[model samples]
Target: MEKTRAILVDITKCIGCQSCEQACKQVHGFPMETEARLSPTALTVIEEHGDKFVRRMCMHCEDPACASACLVGALRKTATGPVTYDGAKCIGCRYCVVACPFSVPRYEWSKLAPLVKKCDMCAARQSAGQLPACVEACPTGASIVGWRDEILEEAERRILGDAKYVKHIYGSQEAGGTSVFFLSDVAFEKLGFAAAPQQPMPVLTANALGDVPTVVMVGGAVLSGIYWITQRRVAVADEERRER
Candidate 1:
């Protein structure tokens, strides 16, 4: 019932200006330069696909795999949308990086105390009732953010109204729906978007990790028993040597 935010991205409207990329970097106080990939410094990236340009960022899934994979609850899927991260709660497990379907989360590999980095759809800015930096900085109306349902309606409207638009809404059912949606004149696969499963990843992740705790408990008990036996043997040998 709580209205979650979504960003509707029209790839056809993008002009390869890189304005959105610049805005993301500036807002995050990075180098102010666009990178080829999503790094700790760059939350969003603009990739040139021949004459078309596509933007890539966190999909902000309805049920995010990154949040589920986090051992310390470092990542969270907020009700208003945005997969937010808390560095303090993070335990440097890097499980989130592995669990992400879109390959969105990045680890700060160079730093001694590294952070898992990715976009949160500008959670702070949205909380202040402002548009995301990338959306606000778009010279063209390529990207717009609003309620998830409303954005889906708009995406449908455009696809239905225009013959040039693709029939598929990229993020609508991908990984059980994401806050970020895409409208492209070209096929998403051609634009380098991976076809994600319709099932939410958290389900699969939870099932996989569910057995881990049991395994660890059993393994620890076995190791403890071995240690106790080894220590007892050493103590018995010492007594024998003293008696002799």
Candidate 2:
């Protein structure tokens, strides 16, 4: 039995109260900081736009480009469907930083041995039959954690039932179906979300790298043959000079 996790974010329901951000910090045992500055330890945060507030956190993509870009497998999509990172395996290369489609992963720029961090969907709490701290803290039910498919279906249902919804599910198909999906009353662009490509981010790169093993083996053999022929030709030329 495979476990799949997801977060359903109804941006329309959010009141920008900042309780979810606080709950995330408390549940994760992260240190507190002043409201404006974001630290690597802060996995979730509230962003203000005019009179509205938006919450930002990792989307936990089904096929995370961060996991694909990681050369040493530092980032991985767990069986439970959360994209988790193992700090010990990270070399701080920052490839994952560039590869993330949602721009979810954040780096600690000030530290000597900086680490990349993001939300893990709170696997421990889910295991304990509890909801994620962010979900629990949301006063308006803005963020809810559940099955990925169900979340997507529900978001679609809402849009179909109400013409007021913008008719876009932010993470539904972006980066190959993110574990998290967002529903908004206003256009997502107005809320500061960039338009995402339809294809999975890794698919473009993986198509090229998929041939790497075969290309390397074939290339090595051809180069070896060329070297052998060059050496043999030099030996023959030397022999002819000696005969003359």
Candidate 3:
């Protein structure tokens, strides 16, 4: 089996160069923009958090809520540890957008027919045994990619070895663990990180979805009963008119 890939982001090492952002745009054939945000064209962004630079992108959860929210299976967590989207399969309902805890997915609002967009962790590059474009483009070694287990261990080592680290590994357990991990000197909440539930969202989504069949069956029965009663009333009214 292919080992799950992951990325470790050391916020302390980042210089806010925006190299990763530029690289992502270039690789995806998106037009260059002066300001980068988590938009349809820009899959990632580097936010200036006072003296620190925070990189924001898809978390790629182990059990992604976006994938679960996709009724048509347009979004899926691949075996290689990236959450990928199939534009053809997408119905443009935007359920994934609402379901994502990280609020990472973007839509091409300007396009006639738009599709949801987010980082796929450069799955094509990884399949060819190359690092992700952003990780490779990083001038500083802020963005590092490796196997998930190894990366987690490396994040631990950095925190343990350095007194500057904040001691919390963001994404390690948030939203049921993500493929991307972060080591920050400042509190993640101060960096605009959302407070996410520890439990995997897929569990909740699945439980809700499991109730769909029952709900549909009960609804159908009630609607049928109402229709039958209405038809009987109409028939009785017609018979009374004929007798009169």
Candidate 4:
């Protein structure tokens, strides 16, 4: 089998330059800069925690809750490590948004036909023998990509070699592991990292969804349909108003 990929983020080395954020915007064609948080237009963002900066993006969970909650399989965790989204297959059901532990998926509220958005870790670039835009733009080697196992080994090496480093690897067990990992000098919580259960999030989602009555499931589908129609009408009305 071909090897899977992972990105190890060394928080200790990051200078908070925002180069990765800029490169992500350029590659994704996002004209507006979202300096604060992830949006449909912004795939990544770097936030300050005192002197330390933390980058946020899709965790690409090994068993993604977003993929599990997707009633229409629009979000899928690929074998190669990225969690990819298919807008064509998306029915505008934002269950993925609610299901995500990291709140990574963004819905385009202003668009006539909105799609969920997040980082795919530049899967196309990897296929073409290029690094992810964000990873390549990082000058201090804060973000480095490699085979998942190799990256895990590297993470451990850094922790062991340096006494100043935090003893924990953020993504190593979070949500039963993710394509992205973070290393830092201080406790993770102090750096704005969300507390994640070590158990795979999808498993929790599946159990919860399974217990719902069939009537509720049907009602959910109806509600999703209604939501799509409502969004379409609202967007269309706005366009007409602008024209008038």
Candidate 5:
């Protein structure tokens, strides 16, 4: 019954305008960076491909590996669906950096006490019942924040209605269905979307980790059984020798 925090980015609608990126930096109160800061303060950035713009941002995965990898619990997802961070709890270990599939989280490597930073989906603004700065600033409504399920259905509807669309939703299946989704007219790879596998990136690693305890427990039990059987056999052999 509640609106889950989600962001929908339609590459087909983006016009290579940097307004969305600028709005994100401005709203977050982040330090002003040059156009080069495109990769840092700007949580989302648009890339020109032929004639269209491909915007990039954190996918905000339903099962975020970044959250899983954070030993200090700095990275977390709220019921509202925004993946948020707590700087006070962060030890600046950079586990989230390694775990992020989209490479969205950036560390302040230049600072003496470097901290990680990424999009919070303008959570404070959302709390005030407003849209994210990027979404509000998007001149063409290319980016809008809403519920994840509703947005996915809308993306599906667009693909079904438009024959020109690529028929592939970028974030729907990548990394286990992210809150952010994309519809593109051209190939997603051409737009610089990472070549994500059909399966979620974290799934493979998670499965491996899940099996570890099982494997160790089973292995230990089997070895113990074998040791007991061997000891029994040795005892029997010693008794046979004593009888002879």
Candidate 6:
């Protein structure tokens, strides 16, 4: 299998230029917005944190909770490392939105037939041997794309070499590791990053879904038995009436 691809975000290097945001909008053909947030049109956004600027988008988890939560398999994790969505298969259940730790998935409320939207790391471009739009547009090289393991190693190297960066590597183990990694000088919490559990969320979701079949079987048997008894009672009453 091909090694999973990933993106390294160096928060310390970001200049709040919003070039990444512009690139994302241009590629997706979304209208330019003054304030971008996770929405059907806006796939990525840059948020300011005091003196720091933090870029936010889909983390593209190794074991994505959204994919697990999807009943129709609309959301899926690609082997090459993007959590992609298939709108044609989507039933608009919005389960992915509720399950995502980063809350990256957004719904189109205005559309007659809406689809959930989030970044897929520019999967089409990656397949064509190109970097993601955001990464390509980053003039400061704050956003970079590479193999997951290599990116993680590079993030550690930078942190070790520079005193400005915090020791922790965000997305390294958060929610059982994500394709997108972040290096920051300040605490990640201050930059609006979620403190997710180290274990992958799919484990929990799988356990719950695994019981569904057994429940359905047991419930069906109980209902059938009740109906049988009811029918027997009615037959007995009719016979008794005829005998009387």
Per-residue lDDT of model 3, residues 70-98, tens digit only: 99999999998999999999999999999
Deviation from native of the Cα of residue 78 in model 3, angstroms: 0.4
lDDT of 4 by residue, 98-141 (tens): 88888889999999999998999999898899999999999999
After best superposition, candidate 5 residue 221: deviation in angstroms?
Answer: 6.1
What do the candidate models score in CA lDDT, each in turn?
0.92, 0.83, 0.93, 0.91, 0.81, 0.92
243 Cα displacement, candidate 6 (Å): 21
Give the clashing pairs for model 4: none
Off by over 4 Å in 1: 207-244
Q: Which candidate is the best by lDDT?
A: 3
State TM-scores per candidate. 0.85, 0.90, 0.86, 0.83, 0.83, 0.87
Task: Estimate, for each residue in 107-205, the C-alpha lDDT of model 1 and write its tens digit.
Answer: 999999999889999999999999999999998899999999999999999999999998999989899999999999988999999888898989886
- The C-alpha RMSD in Å for every predicted model, in order, reads 5.8, 2.1, 4.1, 14.5, 3.1, 3.3
Query: Candidate 5 at residue 240, lDDT?
Result: 100
76-158, model 5: which lDDT tens digit per residue?
87778888989999998898888787778988888898778888887888898898888999999888777788888888898
Ranking by TM-score: 2, 6, 3, 1, 4, 5
Error of 2 at 237 (Å): 3.1
For candidate 5, give the lDDT: 0.81
**Residue-wise lDDT of candidate 2 within 6-40, one digit each (tens)?**
89888778888888888888987777663543458
After superposition, candidate 3 runs with Cα above 4 Å error = 212-244
Model 1: how far is 171 from its true place, Å?
Answer: 0.7
**Off by more than 4 A, model 6:** 212-244
N/CA/C clash count, model 1: 0
lDDT tens per residue, model 6, 1-244:
6799999999999999999998999999888874646778878888888999999999999999999989999999999999999999999989899999888899998999999989999999999998999999999999999999899999999999999898999998899999999999999998889999898999986888889999899999999999999999999999999999
